[model samples]
Target: MLDSQSILNVLRPVQDPELQKSLVDLNMIRNVTVTDGHVSFTLVLTTPACPLREFIVEDCEKAVKTLPGVESVAVDVTAETPQQRSLPDRQGISGVKNIIAVTSGKGGVGKSTVAVNVAVALAQSGAKVGLIDADIYGPNAPMMLGLSAAQVKVQQSGQSEVLEPAFNFGVRLASMGFLIDPDQPVIWRGPMLNGIIRQFLYQVDWGELDYLIVDMPPGTGDAQLTLAQAVPMSGAVIVTTPQNVALMDARRGLRMFQQMQVPVLGIVENMSYFIPPDMPDKQYDIFGSGGGQRTSEELGLPLLGCIPLEMMLRQGGDRGIPIVVEYPDSASAKALTSIAQQIAARVSVLALA
Candidate 1:
């Protein structure tokens, strides 16, 4: 018969799929028993409806079966309640905090880029901030924050656990991209998407954040609904290009937030114009002009700022260095910084009121 210690040694290779930590390290392996070449154990999961439970169980079984003299492996999975899953007496983020959602009607309007820079800028302003890449289908906050492909270490407290979000540019971040391969698509339905959003809110160790900026996916879809229902957002920032098509989409995005009773913070016009470095004064309206300003005015919202169409912005995003950080003195960078300050001021006023 395999000794309990020997069985544990074999089982050490088993990992919780979602948590991505060894069962042994997570302290999830419980009630290990060995008798007559039969090994039995309990696997405590973070959630009762944990989607990866079956995989974890199979992995545990396979690992134990590899041990000499192990004839049968019995694995039972159990889940902890949300309260039980959290550290003891730990309070969640307070109500005084603001949760802002940065969204767009369509993609490619630099929504994620704006989200990343805004979060970092807020952090730079000394507010304890966190960023959630709630765009399940296209999680780019990890990449924008220079944390793409980074794995966060999950810690356990008795029967509870918490995910440690990765940090970059002085802001804490959580993204679906971090949990799955970048090439793999998140083909999840509404319910599954809701669960994922909740997990990010309650399972991650986002301690004492003054603001949590959620980078929402484009469109008025299940992801947006999930965020509206799961968290009380202070406001939403709509990103759009200075074009009619983008403005139409921005209108839909703004209306969705308003319908959900989330405040429309303002509109940010991206790729507003292009100014070649050689001729700084010569400005070309690449995507046309005044769409963002018009949309904001029509929606009765503020035109927060306009981000120029610049190669550095794209290059910075691709390289995990936001233009705001890489070229703070540039016109576009300074514009974003000023926008960041304006957002901070607006949120601060709301907090006071």
Candidate 2:
């Protein structure tokens, strides 16, 4: 029988490609199991999107196989993205591990829909998640989450008053929409916008969270810059439609995040296709096709998932229920869930790194 200690020794020589440190030293080796002559263990990677994942896996397997008594080596690769390294003058969110900004270049591409669904899906998967409607001028999260008439409550915490976030679909949510009357319009200047963004980020009592998804305003504007600079974001996801116009804006959004030193996690093509329930076999390219893929390829980022145009998706949003929760068995729901899984996995891995 090969002892766990012996297996650890074998893996000690295998270093993570990115970190260039022994796996043991990184504390990435998990669930070591030895049965007869076969040895198996899991390698917890820094990011599921790690470009060198294959290299590390192969190296780990080879190292274990070289042991004198080893008959076979089995390695499982898992990832957890590390928390963003704190930036100067910006304190980390209380109990938040990772922050993901969901943005687009132009509006009407269903960016908020994507953000809300992704947050709900992550929560459904047993992870603590928070959602922030950072689009101050056009706050729509309250309506989308079915909390349009809801108001943010205040709680006294010693010397400070914390804003309580609304809850629905298993996600904690903060939005200016909750505070302002639905019929009123916000005509604030840049300074006021910055203050609102800061208050939502720092004043809300978002208890320890696994992920905080920020639904960013459309375009590269002051609000976007304020949010990006105020938080040490783990990464960002660009949402676009399969149309040249949407793609053009999405490219700008991607570049903006990259320039701010925030990693572009991937691109999601919203409204990729439409299929009527009566005619399930035919697919309609309502917004043209391949724009998201082209943007992802041209920019060297991953294409996370393509969400289809469907009535269920719209109805779920209007009813304050995410499609991921309302129609988990539907194709659209599956795509959203898969994308959520990818985001969570990548975020966890990156956070660890």
Candidate 3:
């Protein structure tokens, strides 16, 4: 008979590509209703930014179509992000399902750029996203996120002050840039960094975020340690350039996370090559190549993606607009989006495990 039971029975063999399990078993397929000859159901994904959404839906459709009397199939798609497993000594943000740290061992590897665009891409995919500029010393996320002059408001909640984050490009941002003067430099000692990082993580009104992307300053220092010890992280993405020095730093950063018992999701190689706008057909590997892949292979971590250097990418950042939003068709933008999807997929798998 053409019923919900048969529909689910067919879909039982159709598994989530990433999780390698039945969608039905995962309880991702739900709300079945049959009418006339039409069969419809909901496909609830683990993350909104699932890279293979189309393929999963297609598989569901094909599976349902094989039923003896099914005339048509309709799958309404939705997502529910899972919470990361908490560590014994670490506390989780109340409404945040996952916390992702985007960092590097050394400076100037486009770590902030990756963090910002990844947050924007997740938001674009209908995920509730937040970004914390944990780069306390040089808080550029405000400028890059188009909130250069934006101020974060503080509201009294009980006895403590809670910060209200600035929002743009679908990603809410909490940064030292929003709290400090534009020309002023944060010259605090190492001991003082912990308070500010914790405040950014816990004292902000994140309000039910699926992913909170923390953009950490370069190096494995106080800020990185404070965060790992303070909260349960979904994973860390080490950003690097296609250079030996950057790769060396990335290794140190990855090891730090592993030692702290935080999952190192993968590595992101930015500025892998230069794609000159004037010469659309030409490519230049100014920073060298394959370093990220080699490092990932050597270290046994995933090489999430490689973003090409493009003039427009910097311009977009300077213009307070992300490449993913301003020039979605650009190569860098596409790479960033794919990396965001990969991060989300990894987070889901980790959460499920």
Give all TM-scores, in the order shown.
0.71, 0.73, 0.75
Residue pairs with clashing backbones, model 1: none
Off by over 4 Å in 1: 1-92, 189-191
Among these predictions, the greatest TM-score belongs to 3
lDDT of 3: 0.87
Q: Who wins the lDDT comparison?
A: 3
- In candidate 3, what are the lDDT values of residues 1-353, reduced to their tens digit? 88888888989999767445567755678899889879999997655776889999999999888877788999999875333322446788999999999999888889999999999999999999999999878888888999998867899999999999899989999998877666665565356788988898889999999999999998877688788888989899999888888867887787567645688999999999999999966889997889999999987899999999999999999899999999999999999999999999999998888
Q: For candidate 2, what is the TM-score? A: 0.73
Candidate 2, run of 10 with poorest lDDT: 81-90
lDDT of 1 by residue, 1-353 (tens): 47878888888877655333456755578789998988888887655776767878888888887777888989887865422533322223553288888888887788888889988888888888899998877788888889986889888956768889999898999888877766665564345787888888888888888889888887877677667656666778888888888867876676455444466789999889998877877889977899988998887888889988877888898999988888887778888888888787777776676
Q: Per-residue lDDT of 3-119 in model 2, one digit per residue for the tens?
A: 888899888888765434566755678789999888889887545786877888889888888888888888888865433322335567979989899988888788899998898
Alpha carbon deviation, residue 40, candidate 2 (Å): 59
* Regions of model 2 farther than 4 Å from truth: 1-88
